[model samples]
Target: MNLTQQISEDMKTAMRAADTKRRDAIRLLQAAIKQREVDERIQLDDAAVVGVIEKMLKQRRDSIVQFEAAHRHDLADAEKYEVSVLQAYMPQALSDAEIEEAVSEAISIAGAKGQQDMGRVMAQLKSSLSGRADMGKVSSLVKTKLIG
Candidate 1:
């Protein structure tokens, strides 16, 4: 099933199981997806849905960091729960080694040389690695590869 369909089914399941936390998280995801559709006036495909999920996950991670930095462990833990819920829909994340391999391949494919080509390398990497690996780490690896 497509992500939207899967999420809908999961939402029903969550309701049937009386899973309040999962239900709320799934509802939040649905709201985000619906809001995007209304704003853009276009239905999102699975990839677009995945993009939305990734965006939500990033927001949760940022919130977690901010909460922890402010010494709010309770808030941080709450954000972590949200993150876990959102992560259920994501594909298995690529390992560091896998990410590095992909980065190397992207560099070669883009013919990236020196720091001047960082933008091009980054664009390729983003397209190639989106939803699979952390862009921040991928960027650092790209810089290291280009410089060293």
Candidate 2:
């Protein structure tokens, strides 16, 4: 099944099992996906769905940090639980070694020479690394590789 169909199935499962937390998390995700589709006036494929998931994950991580800093463990824990639920749909994360190798290959493929070529290199990497690797970390690696 496609990601959307899979999400729908999971949502049904969550509801049937009386998993309010999971169900609520999935509802939020579905809302985000639907909002994006409405705003863009286009149907999102699996890749776009993954993009939405990543965006939500980033938001939750930020909230977790802020909540913890404010000594709000309860809120932070809730955000963490949401993160766990959202992560179930993400593609398998790339290992550090694999990410490094992919970055290196992307750099070479883009013929990136120095810092100025970072954008080209990143654009190349984004397509291959999206959902599987953290772009921020990949960017830093690209900078280090290009500078050194």
Candidate 3:
């Protein structure tokens, strides 16, 4: 089943099981998806749905970091829960080694030799690695490869 259909089915299960947290998270996801569809005036494919999920996960990660830094462990934990739920829909994340390999390949493909080429390298990396790796880690790996 497509992501949207799968999510809809899961939402029904969550409701039947009385899983409030899961149900709420699923509703939030549906809202985000619906909002995007309405704004864009187009139906989102599975890839686009994945993009929305990734965007939500990224936002949660940022919120978790900020909350933790501000000594709001409770808020941070809540955001982490949302992140976990959202992650269930994401593609399997790349390992560090895999990210490094992908970065190496991207650098070579972009002919990125130094800091000046960082932008081009990063652009390619974002396109290739979106939803597959943590971009912050990828950026550091690219810098190391380019500078070393």
Candidate 4:
């Protein structure tokens, strides 16, 4: 099944299981997907849905960090749960080694030699690696590879 269909089925299961937190999380995901579809005037494929989920997860991670910095342990913990739920919809994360390999490949493909070519390399990597790896880390690796 597509991500959207799978999510709808999971939502039903969450409701039947009386898992309110999971159900709410799924609803939140659906709302984001629907909002994007409405705004963009296009139906999102699974990849697009995954993009939305990844964006939500990133926001939750940032929130968790900010909450913890403010000593709001309870809020941070809640955000952590939301993050976990959101993660279930994404592709498996690429390991550091895999990310490095992909970065090297991107560098080669873009013929990137230095910081000046960083944008081109990153654009290539972003299209190819978006949900599979953290772009921040990938960018760092690309920089070191190009410079060293």
Against the true structure, whose lDDT is highest? 2
Residue pair clashes in candidate 2: none
- The lDDT for every candidate, in the order shown, is 0.91, 0.97, 0.91, 0.91
lDDT by residue (tens digit), candidate 1, 1-148: 8889999999999999999988999999999999999999999998889899999999999999999999999999988888998898987889998998888888898898898998998998887688888888888999999999
Pairs of residues clashing in candidate 1: none
lDDT of 4 by residue, 9-109 (tens): 99999999999989998999999999999999999999899899988988999999999999999999988998988888889888888888888888888
lDDT of 1 at 10: 95
**What digit string (tens of lDDT, one per residue) describes model 2 on residues 24-72?**
9999999999999999999999999999999999999999999999999
Per-model TM-score, in order, reads: 0.94, 0.99, 0.90, 0.95
Position 111, candidate 3: lDDT: 86
Alpha carbon lDDT at 3, candidate 4: 95
Pick out the ten consecutive residues of candidate 3 with the lowest summed lDDT.
127-136
Model 4: which ten-residue window has the lowest total lDDT? 134-143
Q: Kindly report which residue stretches of model 1 are placed more than 4 angstroms away from their true locations once superposed.
A: none
Candidate 1: what lDDT? 0.91
Q: List per-candidate RMSD values in Å.
A: 1.2, 0.5, 1.6, 1.0
